[model samples]
Target: MYVYDEHDRQIAAERVAQFRDQTERALAGELSEDEFLPLRLQNGLYVQRLAPMLRIAVPYGMLRSEQLRRLARVTRDYDKGYAHFTTRQNVQLNWPALEDVPDILAELAEVEMHANQTSGNCIRNTTTDQFSGVQVDEVADPRPYCEIIRQWSTFHPEFAFLPRKFKVAVNASEKTDRAAIQVHDIGLQMVRNDQGELGFRVHVGGGLGRTPMVGPVIREFLPELDLLTYLEAVLRVYNRYGRRDNKFKARIKILVKALTPEGFAEKVEAEWSHIKDSPTRLTREAIERIQGYFTEPAYDALENATELLASQRFDNRQFDQWLSHNVDSHKKPGYAIVTLTMKKTGTPPGDVSDTQLEQIAELAEQYSFGEVRVTHQQNVVLADVRQDQLFELWQSIEPMGFATANLNTLTDVICCPGGDYCALANAKSIPVAESIQRRFDDKDFLYDLGDIDLNISGCMNACGHHHVGNIGVLGVDKKGAEFYQVSLGGSSHHDATIGKILGPSFAQEDMPDVIAKIIDVYVDNRKEEEPFLETYRRIGIEPFKERVYA
Candidate 1:
C-alpha cells in the first residue's frame, strides 16, 4: 500500500470540497443534468437502473487493511451491506442516494482515495497486476507509475473532455495478468533489452465495445524516462483527430484503425520528436522516488518449508484442494500468494458482505502483512501468506464461504451486475454466471477443463470482459427477449486475443446445454492433459463450432 504524501492528501481533500459543491448545485437544480453528468461521472457516480451507483477507485486494486476497513464501513453506513468489485479493479456501491455521494467521496478522500476519472470521458484508473510488487516475475512494481499517471490525468485541462472514455493499463511482468493489453486505449508493458536497459512496449488503439481490436504495437521500446512525454504525444494525437461526430466511432481504437498502426506510429513519432526529453520527462531521481513507494514489504526469512504445513496439506483434503487452486507461488520463501476467492458456488461473483470485508481485514492483520489486494478477476488476494498457517487460514475463510478453489477454472467466472443493477444491460448476467457455475460445480470436471476463463457481460461495454475469455458469453436482447452470444478462443494472458462470436445467439434457457456441448468438444478432442487454450489453438474453433451449432 502506497501512502499518500502531503500533496496527494491536499489534492484529494480539495477535490472532495469541489465535488461536494458540484453535487449540492446539481441537487438544488442550479446545475442541469447535462451540466451535472460529467461532473457526477468524474466523481464516479452513475445514475443506473434503480439508484445511483458510486464506483470507488481502488488504484491498481491495491489497498491497505485500514482502507479496506473504510470501504467496509462505507458500504455498511451508506449503501447496502456489501459492495461489487469490478473488473477494472474498482468497487461499486449500488444503492447510494444521489445527495450522499459527496459525503461518500469525502469519506474516501480521508483515506487518500477518490473517484476522480473513474467514469468520465477522461483517463480512468490505471490498472496493473495485483501482484505487482509481490510476484517473482515482475520487472518492477507498476503502481508508482500508475499513481503518477493518476496525478497527471486527474484534471488534465486538455483531456477533460475526450471523444470517449479512455483506459490505460500497465503490466511489468513477463506474464500478462493485466490481459488483452492489445485492447486498451494505451497499454504499457515494462521491458528489458539485451543491453538490460529498461523501457516499455507501447500498444495503442486496443479496445472492446461494438468493435474489439487487439492493440497495435506502435513503439517497440520506449526509454522509461520518456514515458510521460510519449504518452502525451499519443493522447494529443487521439484528442486532436479522434471522431466527435459519432460516439460509437470516437474511441482511440477507431482512430488507430482509421490511421493504421504504422501511420499512427508515424504521427506519434513526429509529435514525440519535440516533446521527448522535455522537462516532464522522468528523471532518475523521479523513478527512484516512485520505486521507493513500492519497495518490497519486509518479510521474515524462513528458508525451510515447514514439515508440519506439508503434513497438514495431506491431512486435510479440503485444504489441499485450496492450496492447489487458490494459492500461487510467492517470490519469498515459506510464503505463498493466496487468492481469497469471492466466487463461492451460489452467490454473485465479487459481492462481498460487510462482515466478510471485516473478516478479510482482520485476516490481513493476522495472516498477511496487513494488506490485501482486490484482483481484476474479482477476488481478494492475501499476497504474503505464511505456508505454515495455511490450514488455519483455510479454516477461517471456508466458513465465511470464501474458500472456493476455482481460480482460473470455469466456475471462477468474471461477471458484471448486469440487468439486475445496470441500466445499460439488456439481460441479467449474474444469474447466467450462477447457472454456468452450477453446471460445472464438479471439481474433477472443472480440473479437466483446466485454466479456462469464462467471462460474461450483459451488454456491449464488455464490462465483464466477455471479449477476452477463453469461453466468452455476451447477453443480448432479441425482440425484447433475453439471449446470449457465445464466443470461443479468446484469452487474456501473454498471448492475448479476442474471442470470435460462434453464430446466432442462443435463447437464455439453452445456455447450460450449449456450455455442456462446448465442454464435450474439448473433452473429446483435447490431446492428453492439454488445457482449454492449448486445445482450442491446436484444433481451432471449427470442431467446437460444429458441435455447438449442430
Candidate 2:
C-alpha cells in the first residue's frame, strides 16, 4: 500500500478546506444548485434518487486497516450503517445529508482518504488488479504506475473538465486482465520486450454504455520512462477533439471511432514527439521512488503450506470449495490471496455494514499485513494471507457473510445500485440481482455451472459493467414499465467481448427464468466441463438465444 507523503497529506487537507467553503456557501443559498453542481460532483457527491450519495475513492482499490476503520466510522455517523461498494473500486454512502458531506470528507482526510476525482467529467480513479503485487501471474506490479497516474491526475488543471469522464486501467498480468483494460478510456498493459525491459502496450477508445467497444492497441510498446509523457499526449488529443456538443457522444471512444485507432495513434504520436523528453517524462529515480512504496510485506520464513492446506481440504468439503473459489496463488509459496466475497445472498452484491467493515479491518491487520484491497468485482482482497492460516481465516469470515465461496461464479454477480438509489436508473437492479441470486442460491449448482459472470446495470451507463458479463442483464423502461434485457457470451477477461442480446426484453418477473434457460442451453451444449463463456463461444449464441426465447 502506498502511504501518503507530506505533499499528499497537504493537498488532501487543502481540498477539504476548499470543498468545505463551497458546501457552506451552497447550504446557505449563497451558491445556487447550478453553481454548486460541478463543485459537489468534483468532490464525489451525487444527488441521487432519494438522498445525497458521496462516493469515496479507494484509489486502485487499496486500503489500510486504519483507513477501513475510518470508513466504518463515517458510515456509522454520517449515513446509513452500510455503504455500497461500486464497480469503479470505490465506496458510496447513499444517505448522507447535504450539510454533513464536508464534515464527512474532512473526517475521511484524517485517514489519508478523500472523495476527490471520484466523479464528474474528469479522470476518475485509476484502477488495476487487486492482486497486483502478490499475484503469481503478474510480469510486474502495476500499482506504482497507477500511483504515479493517481498523483498526476488528482487535480490537473488542463484536463480537469474534459467533455466526459475518463477512466484508465493498468495491468501487468500476462495471462489475465483483472483490470478489464480493454473497456477503459485508456488501457496500459505492461509487457517485456525481447530485451526483457518492461513497458506498456497501450490501448485506447474502449468503453461500454450506449456504445460498447473493445479499444484498439494504439502503441505496441511504449518504454517505461515515457509513461507520463505518452499519457499526456493521449489526454491532450482527447481533451482537444472529443465531442462536447452531446453528452452521449462526448466519450474518447467516439473520437477513437471517428478518427480511427491508427489516425488517433498518429495524432498522439505527433503530440508525443514534442514533449517526450520533457520533465514530465518519468526518470529512473522517480520510478524507483514509487516502486519502493509498494515493497512486499515482510513475509515469514515458512515452508509451502500445500500439505497442510490439502489436509484441511480433505477434512472439510466447504473449506475445499472456498479454497478453490476464493483463494488465489500468491507470488510467495507460503502465502495466498483471499477474496472476501461481498456477493452473499440477500445482500446487494457489495454492501458492507459498519460492523463488517470493522471486523474485516481487524482480520486484515491480523492475517494480511494490515492491508486490504477493494476489487472491481465488488469484493475485498486480503492479498497476503499465509496458506497455513487459510482455514482459520475462512472460518472467521464466513459468519461475517464475506466468505461466500462464489468468486467468479454466477452467484458472485457484479451489480450496481440501480433505480433503488440512482435517479438515472429506469428500473431497480437490487431486486433483479436478488431474484437471480435466489434462483441459483444452491452452491452445488453454481459450482457445477463453473465460472460465469452475471452482471446487472440499472441503465445504459453500465455501472455494473453488464455488457461484459457472461450473462448480462440491463434494466430498461418500456413505456413506463420496467423490463429486463439479457445478453449472452459477454466477457471482460482475456480477449474481451461485448455480449449480444438474446431477443425481446422480458418483464421483471421473468428474468430468472430467462437466465435459467440461458444456463440450460449452456449445460446442454457444453463440451465436458467447459465454462459458460467457452460453451457460449463454441455453440454460438443461437442455441442460448433460442432456448432463452423458447
Candidate 3:
C-alpha cells in the first residue's frame, strides 16, 4: 500500500521517455535485434515462442484497484486481452507490439509501476510475503525493506551487468510464506535476538533451474541497519569472483557450491571489512520513514461475527466448501484473508479474462480494502475481507468464475505458460495440469489429500517451482513425443527440499494414471489421514518409487 513518492514518479516517467526513444530506433532498423536485446530485457521484454512478452513488475505483489485497472486497460489496448501472473508476482503481457512497448511503459508509470530490473543480470524484484502486513505470524512487515532494496538495486551502475541474473527474497514472518531462505540467489529472514534487537539470518547460494539447491546460512544475525551495506559486500564478492566464461556456471549458487558455504562467507566478510559502516548503511531515520509507508490500514472497531454469515454457511453447502478452502486467518481479529482461486477446473492455472479482472477490481472495493495482491502461486488475494461478508463475497466471486475452493489442494496447481506461450518450453504444461485435475475431480478425495502443492514446469528452468511441489511434474520431449517426469517429496516450507525423480519419464497419456498410482501408495501406506508430504517423508520415496516403477 505504499504510494509512490514524487521522486519515484519522476524517475519512472523519465525512464519511459528514454525507452520510447529506444523503441523508435529499434523499429526504424537503426538498432538491430542484437543491439536491442539487452535494452529490451532491461525493460522486461522477452521474445517468447509466439510473440514478444512484456513482464510488468508488481512490487512485493501489492496492487491498488487503480493499478489493477490500469493493467487491465494495458492488456485490452496493447496486447491480448489477458495477462499471465508469474510466480515472482509479476504479470506478463504476451502480445505487445515492439513499437507499442514504450507506450505501455508510460501507462505503467502513471500508476507508479514499471518493468525496470524485472530482468537482466541485476537483482530482480525483491519479493516478500503476499500477506506481509496481514499475516497472523508476521515478526515484522517486510515491504519497507523490500522497497528499500528495490530502490538500491534498480539500475545500480555497479550491478547492472552482472555475470548472470540475480534474485533476492526477504521474509519477516515466523512462517515462511515468501519461501525466503530457500532456493534463492540470496535469502534474508528477519529475526530478533536474545537482546530483542532486529537482525537477519542470511542464506547464500540457493537457486532453482537446471540445478536446484537450498541456500546455506552464512550469517546468523546481521543487524537491521547494516542490511544494505552487508548485501553490497555479498554482491561485490560474487561480481568479482563468480565465473564469467560460462553462463550456466555464472549464478551465485555455482560459486557458493565451488567455494563451499564457509569459504563464501569468508570471501564476503573480507569484502565487508572495508565497508561495514559505510554511508550505504540504512539509517534509523530512513528505516522509520520507509516503515511508515507500510503502516496498517484503519479498520472499523465493530465485532466481526455475523448472523448473516452463519445463516449463509448453513444454507449453502457450496459456500461452505469455498469458505473452507479459500479463507485464511488474518492478523486482525475482525478480518480474514481470501484467496480468489484462479485454478477453476479445466482452465489454465492463472489465466483471467479482461472482464474477470474488472470484476475482481470491483469485488476488492466491495469486500475489503480497494487493494488486491498477486501471490507467488499465481492466485489473487483479497487480503482484508471482513469475516462477516464472506458468504456474500463468495456469491459475487462465484459468478465471475473466481470461487474455486481449492486453495492448496491438488487442484490448486502452479503451472507455467509453457509451449502454449513460451518458446523455451519443450512441451505444454497447462494441458498436463488440466489432465491431472480432470482425473482428480472428486472433491472429497482432493480435500482428503490435504494441502498438496502440484507445480508443473514446461522445461528444466523450473519456472513453475516444480522442484518444490509435493507433486511436481516436469514436461520434456523425446523423439518428438512429449513425456512427463514425476518427482515426489519436494517442499518449499520450513523444511525445504527438492524432490527426487521417480524413475523414467512417462508418456503424456500415462501421467494421470502414474499420479493415481503415487496417490494410491500414499493412501495405502499413510498413518491416519496423513498429508501427502507427511506420508512421503515417513515412508521415504522408496515406497512410492517401488510402486510406480514396479
Candidate 4:
C-alpha cells in the first residue's frame, strides 16, 4: 500500500476543510440544493432515496488494516453499524446524515482515505485485479500502473468535469481478465513486444448501461512512457466532442459509437502527436519509484504445505470445499490468496457490519500481512495468506460469516443497492439477489453447478455489471410495476461478451424459478465438467430461453 506523504496529507486536510465550509453553508441555507449538488458530488456525497450515501475510494482496491479499522469506527460512530462494498472495489456508507459527512471525511483523512472521485462526472477510482502481485500468472504487478493512473486522474484540472463519469481499469495477467478492462472507459492491458518492451493494449469506449458494448481496441500497443499522455489525449477528445445535451448519452462509449472506432482513434492520435513529448511522459525513475511502493513483502522461505493441506482436506469435507472455491494459487510457494466472500445466504451481499470490519482487520493483520484488497465482485481478499494456515483462517472467517465457499458459483451474486437506496433505481436488487441465494442454499448443488457469474442490477445504469454475468438479472419497470429481465451467456473474463436477453421480463416472484429453469437447462445440456458460460456459448441462449420462457 502507498503511504501518504506530507503533501498528500496536506491536500486531504485542505479538501476536508473546504468541504466542511461548503456543507455548513448548504445546511445554513446559504447554498441552494442545486448550488451544492456539484460540490457535494465532488466530495462523493449523494442524496439517495431515503438518506445520504457517501462513497469512500479504496484506491486500486488496496487498504491498510488501520484504514479498515478507521472505516469500522466511522460506521459505528457516524453512520449505520454497517457499510456496503461496491463492485467498483469502493465502500459506501448508506445512512450517513448529510451534516455528518464532513466529519466523516475528516475521520477518513486521518487514515489516508477520502471520498474524492467516487462519484459524479469525473475520473473515478482506478481498479485492477485483487490478486495483482500475489497471483501466479500476471506478467507483472498492475497496481503501480493503477497508482500512476490514479495520481494523474485525481482532480486533474483539465478533466475535473467531464460530460459523464469515466472509469479506467488495468489488467496485467496473461490468462485472466479479473479487472474487466474491456468494459471500462479506458482499459489498459499490460503486454510485451518481441524485444520484451513493456506496453499496454489499450481499449476505449467499453461500457455497460442503456447501451452495452465491449470496447474496441483503440491502440494495440501504447508505449510505457506515454501512458499518461495517451490517456490525456483520449480525455481531450472526449471532453471536446462527447455528448452533454443528454445525460443518458454522455458516456465516452456513446461518443465512440457515433464517431466509429477508427475516427476516434485518429482524433486521439492527432491529439497525442502534439503532446506526446510533454512532461507527463512517465520516466524510468518515476515508474520505478511507484513500483517500489508495491514490492513483495518479507516472505519466508518455506515450501508449500502440500502434505498438511492434503491431510486437512482429507479430514474435513467443508474445509476442502472452501479450499477449492475460495482459495487461489499464489505466486509465492508457501502463500495462497483467499477471498472472504460477503454473499452469505441470508445477509445482503457486500454488507459488512462494523464489528465484522474490525474483526477482519485483526484477521488480516494476524493471518496475511496487515493489508487487504477489495475485489470487484464485492469481496475482501487476504492476498498473502500462508498455505499452512489455510484451515485455521477458514475456520476463523467461517464463524464470522465471511467464509461462504461460493466464489464464482450461482450463489456468489454481484448486486447493487437498487431502489432500496438509489433514487435512480427502478426496482429493488437486494431482494432478488437474496431470493436466488436462498433458492440455491444447497452447497453440494452449488458445487456441482460449477462456476457462474450471476449479476443483478436495479436498472439499466448497470452498476451491478449485469451485462457481463453468465446469468444476468436486471430490474425493469412495467406500467409502474417492477419486473425482472434475464440475460444469458454474458462474461467478464478474457473473452468478454454482453449477455443476450432471454425473453420477456418476469414478475419479481418468478425470478427464483426463472433462474432455476436456466440452471436446469445448463445442467441438462452441458458436457461433463463444463462451466456455465462455456455451455451457454456452445448450446446457445435459445435453450435457456426456451426453458426460462416456456
Give each model's whole-structure lDDT.
Answer: 0.88, 0.92, 0.88, 0.93
My TM-score estimates for the predictions, one after another, are 0.98, 0.99, 0.98, 0.99
lDDT of 3 by residue, 207-304 (tens): 88888888999999999999999999999999999999999889999999999999999999999989988899899999999888877777877565
Instruction: Tell me the tens digit of each residue's lDDT in model 2 across 1-550.
Output: 7888899899989999999999989989999999999999999999999999999999899999999899899999988899988888999999999989989999999999999989999999999999898888798989999999998898999899999999999998989899999999999999999999989999999999999999889999999999999999999999999999999999999999999999999999999999999999999999999999999889998778888998999999999999999998888989999999998889999999999999999999999999999999999999999999999999998889988898898888899999999999989999999998999988999888898999999899999999999889999999999998988888898689999988889999998888888888888888888888988888887887667666
Q: Estimate, for each residue in 1-550, the C-alpha lDDT of model 1 and write its tens digit.
A: 5689898898889998998898889889999999999988988999999999999999888878788888899999999999998988899999999888889888988887788889988999888888877788988778888877876787899889999999999999886655446678999988987799888899999888889888989999998888899999999999999999999999999999999999999999999999887887888998787778777767898764668767888888878888889988888898888999999978899999888888999999999878888888999899998887788899999999889998989999999999999999999998889988998889977876788899999999899889999999999999999999999988777788999888899987889889999999999988988998889889888898889888
Candidate 3 ranges with C-alpha deviation above 4 Å: 306-310
Model 2 scores a C-alpha lDDT of 0.92
lDDT of each residue in 1-550, candidate 4, tens digit only: 7888899999999999999999999999999999999899989999889999999999999989999999999999998799999999999999999999999999999999999988989999999999999888888888999999998898899998999999999999999898899999999999997889999999999999999999999999999999999999999999999999999899999999999999999999999999999999999999999998988899998899999999999999999999999999998899999999999987888999999999999999998889999999999999999999999998898889998899999999999999999999999999999998999999999999988999999999999999999999899999999999889888888899999998899999899999999889988998999998999889887888777767
Lowest lDDT block of 10, candidate 4: 541-550
Model 2 regions lying over 4 Å from their true place: none
Ranking by lDDT: 4, 2, 1, 3
Please list all clashing residue pairs in model 2, or write none if there are none: none
Give stretches of model 1 more than 4 Å off: 304-306
By summed lDDT, the worst window of 10 consecutive residues in model 2 runs over 541-550
